[model samples]
Target: MKRFFAKKEITAILFIGILFTLSFFNWRSAYATMKEHTVSYLASAGNKWENLSSFIMDVDNTIHEQVYQKYYYIEGYGYIQELLGKKEINNFEVVKAKDGTLHYTYFTSGPNQVTSLVERMERLKKAATKVGSEVIYVMTPDKYVTGVTEFDKGIPYNYANETADNFLQELEKKEIDTIDFRKLMKEEKEFAPDSFYVSDHHWKVETAFWAFTKFVEVLEDNYGLVFPNKGEYTNLENYNQIVYEDSYIGSMGRKEGKLYSKVEDFTFIYPKFETNFYYYAQNGSRDVKAEGRFEQSLAFTSLLSGKGNIYDATNDKYFTYMNGNPGFVEVNNFNEPDAPKVLFIKDSLMVPVASFFALGCSKVYMIDPRYYSGNIEEVIDEYQFDYIFVSYTPQNLTEEFFPFYKE
Candidate 1:
């Protein structure tokens, strides 16, 4: 019995050894094939591995902070494999001409971007003027340009201010009407330390109010439209509530590679007016309820909503603005007939600013070129706007504006 047991043990050991040797050779060849496939797949997918890898790394860090380090590393390896196998491109930054102004040796695409935007403005202006509508370019300030407290000194490039200056000069040369909000803010010293949110890129609602006031002034001066003073407009500060209190990770914070820090809590402010309001985007027209007062929607809620068909009937609500497609958005105000029909060509930075226009304009048609593939000229012709405003952040201005213009 002992001899039989010994023979069985030796046989088992030999079988296990042979299996290990076969697996070793197989793994090497398999690993080589995997490497080749990964490279080929990445090349076919336009080499988006960097962005995919970064996103995976972020997810890993988030999970790592929650649990074990080994889980994070293992998940990261899986993410790498998935990324290499992907057939589609995810996130990408738009490229622009490198020859432009330099701020602290960090050059910006200010010249090309501004020039191209001005040219688009010229086309838009001619189209609007042909329809007997006025064109007003509303240039919004970036957090860095506006000198928001948290971003006062950290920005590597003074590109925001440079872009603003170049844009203004180019517009002036073309005799285009513009609303320079940055200069107005600077002249008024609106950059009170806490005026901007600590973590987010957007200014506090108070800043928007101030901007609205300036916008009102522009309307009065340029179009001879008179808006009532602050006393006449309802202030909803008392009704303002904190809808969400958790720390937010904003675009800038993510781009700056500082995800660990807590972002400021975003507060949603509503006017003391009634909440009975409805809105819809359809057939190139935005229609709203005629009777009820406009209730301001939560800022963050809008961000949570993703993109879809703009003409769908399901989008006929104020909250729909938050999640609707980024292309052309038409919002109608049923309050007054004489209210201006505005064409707001802007970036994501203009989302919060749309609220101010809601109060002023009878209808606001917003178009984001990043998502819109159709001819911008045709959209302008179809909308028949009374006023046109172009607003964007410095980063987008430097990167995206040129491509849209070139197209």
Candidate 2:
């Protein structure tokens, strides 16, 4: 008994010593990440002190994320904040909502400058309309839903909702068709809390499915791309809902850590009906071409393998949809060959939700302006689709997304 106790004490001491040494290495990596953040900040939107501060918080989050022992470091930091009742982390770069959701926000001096962005949309409309392709601006819900999500005093408000309102209004004036999903979110008040993940900025997969139904409704009512199985398409009962509880930590959750925010439940939803697709996706550097069923070819099930212990921040389960924002993506729905061909030029919010188009449209093509290497006008001219859609989250309403036909 005496020898066993002696060995146990030695093991504990050595383990503690190793952890102490690891802390130095973590900080060293953190400092290097800070330098990268500095360069990235200078290059983009980090023009003001407010932007700089939030961007630095991003650096802090990324540094710890890259460390050898990042999970423990994040756990410790989260615990400290939990004990101190810190509703705001990183000097309000990330704040906990009254409902416990994490948000990336900062104090807004005024509404964002979207006049030029609207002009860019107008130009794209002219080009698309010239080629006989219609343009529709689809607005995804902002994380900070107005009149629903509340934050503690001294927390920052980014006014992204206001900016979205401004942007959509301008598009309407330009006679560009627009879909405001915020209205739908508000109408369904009971599900507002459940609509978005408390730990991340993106909507839940189930919510994305619901949004897709809405997209089909618009296409049917306005553009005449109606589906006979539209009712079956929106029916959640016909889908396989696999709930991976306590497994997700989203982009925002990574920054704040688990203790500061609860682990999210990823409800992976897909159709129970038969489907076939020929999918081709390219992110400029790499390309994937496959032909199979929905789960086989369209979705990346490899991301879902890590049940409850997903730590690599980049291994985000949310990325399971279309394997993340590929620069260019084509889904030929052999199941719906006679259906309309749709196109989306937008952001990551649509990246997952657009998968539902397989059930409705005959063929779907998506371009994430931030990634696609091909010419937008050339693609538009070459393919005269039934409809063309443009969606950018309010927070992402910047010059980078409106990359087509900008004057």
Candidate 3:
């Protein structure tokens, strides 16, 4: 009985000692994560709880990162999916067509959200009208709605397409000037099968160029702005495509890993003509400039324009057009220094399309509403923009884009 008691005492002592050692080593690290630092542990009850909560969250984040939970958890389940030929991941759902195309299921905004967006646009239109600037909303369609679904079994419903169409209908009732690319892309997809990338959500360089020409045509029809040689400007022979074979794994590919969505082509489109332009870019407080050649407007200009292999990550290819995201990009057409100016408010979907506007206009000021903090009315007044373009892909059609004016 004495021996048993002695054993119990020893076990308790050892357990407490080990815990103390661990706490001693980990306390400093855990303390570093506390958002609030109080000299006394007995501060207020609320303060102590808040600090404790912050520490717990930090510790949880550290554990998940250390274990690589995203990769391991998703990849482990992904491996099982591979064996069973499944298409669903935790937050990711991919539809694999027989033609080796992958379509990602996107969540669409509800009616309340859509109504809020329409109201915001109405406010923006009124503001632009006050400054005498014509507001044109450009809607880039989603990949799922591009009509390339011959092999697609249609397992997952496309919220993005349905919501986009609904939103566009509301905009039309308001009689707002709009450019819908869904119809243009659909008509062209029948002839050119590679309008959109196979594994990615973005449109191909060729597809973007076609869309840009359509944009130019609209400017001519609506604003009476003419590119002296519009036909020659839109001609395919004037541009060069840098196509890398089997070199990209897109956003959806990254989610599913290599097994499901394999590597595909990365085609970079740039002008082979006399490319002379001054490009100014700003991201937050940092301002960057590049001049001579249209390549300057692109992100990783050196790499995509011929410094590195196109076979890097899919983001490298997509970002090659205008980098990931910039607060603003100003393009000046040296050829037409006195031409009309346009203020383009866009998401990454319009990255490739900006250069097209630059070609037709004297100056194109590309502003990303996601990051820009200045007043749109002030921008319209200051820049004296003739046209204001608010562009976004259907997937990105949400209230967040217009949050600046929202209540």
Candidate 4:
């Protein structure tokens, strides 16, 4: 009994000593291993809980589907991530502009955002006047503002409408040349119900044609340049239908992750004009050929729908134009001699509209603030364009416009 007791005591002491030695020497590794084990255990438990919950939810969903309608969790875990994920990482990229203003990568900031934007427009006007170029501020409407989708309900403010109205008011007060597309859109509300695509942020090709008519009208009225009216142009109908119908998801829908109803099938049509174009990227400082042919089957087919650095040659083949870099793009008309050079500062909203301007200008220079970080004043001076147009969506106006202004 004594020997057994002594052995038991010895074993306890040995075990304790071994544990202490391990704690002293391998503490970090042991902690790490323990942490990993705990995480794995928690993750396994979470997954099991999720499976069980999903099984139960599926039963309820099945019953709901049978009786009432579809089962949707408007505020679900996936949706939470979708909503918060973007906001968490929504830090703007800031670059120094030649003017005192800080060029934010995505949108605008600072106190009195509207006034700052007006001031910026004034600066652009002064710069344009200095360079002897006409500045036409083309305000593009936002998809959400047009009331196509209800997802924009959660936005903190009605910045789109407010900023647009304020900017227009300020521009008119200063007698700066501008185009209020919002007013035009309101007047042409007959097609608003079906004018835009539910799944995509862009207006349909038909809408583009409508907007193009208005844009051309503005150009002719303001600048004495006559673009052929719609009656004069050859219209090609039924180019293509939505091939993959419901599979398409827009930037907003993707961000929301709520799985709203799919976009409806619609026909895309374009003018039957021979297109020859080149797109210059401000980032790489290189010029490449752009696609002259229009594809009826692809999504966003009207905009030479290629991704990442594509330039289309004068023929039917599509090529990477400017390597997906944002900034200014210059398109030249090789057919016309001593043609007027026009500079367009635009957002993604202008992509489809480029085709319309391409026919009007001898050289159309487009600058996207999302890309291109060079000196805007320098570019304007160097190009010496006769007409300077700034086209932007309301979303972009609230976000990207003021950053380009001189404080």
Q: Identify the leading candidate in terms of TM-score.
A: 2
Instruction: State the number of backbone clashes in model 4.
Output: 21
Q: C-alpha displacement of 331 in model 1, angstroms? A: 1.6
TM-score of each: 0.61, 0.83, 0.76, 0.60
Please give the TM-score that candidate 2 achieves against the real structure. Answer: 0.83
Write model 3 residue lDDT over 1-407, tens digit each, in one string.
99999999999999999888756655544455443343333464566766777556666765433332344454566567778876555454676665666777634344224777887888878877887788888998677644445433535555676678888888988878788888766565523335677767877777788888887887788777766567767877888878877766666666666665566777777777775778788888788787877765543555444344332343467777766568877878887777778887888778788776577678888888788766765676777787888988777777767764574
Ranking by TM-score: 2, 3, 1, 4
Question: For residues 135-202, what per-residue lDDT tens digits would candidate 1 score against the true structure?
Answer: 77777765553333221132334356676778778888998988877777788987543555443445
Winner on lDDT (2 vs 4): 2
Model 1: colliding residue pairs: 279-316
lDDT: which candidate is best? 2
Tens digits of lDDT, candidate 4, 243-279 = 3333233333332233232324444344354545444
Colliding pairs, model 3: none
Residue 200, candidate 4: C-alpha displacement in angstroms:
3.6
Flag the better candidate by lDDT, 1 or 3: 3
lDDT of 2 by residue, 1-407 (tens): 99999999999999999989988787776777778778867777535776777786888787746686667877888889989998887777888888888888888887799999999889888888887888899999888877778988878789898899999999999999998888866676624867888888888898888888877777778866777588887788888989988888888777757777877788888778888888999997688988887887788887888854566655899988788888999999888878888788988898777888767788989999889988998898899877898998899998888777766
TM-score of 3: 0.76
For model 3 the local lDDT of residue 267 reads: 75
- Candidate 1 Cα errors over 4 Å, as ranges: 1-113, 145-155, 226-231, 234-246, 254-259, 275-277, 281-321, 402-407
Descending-lDDT candidate ranking: 2, 3, 4, 1
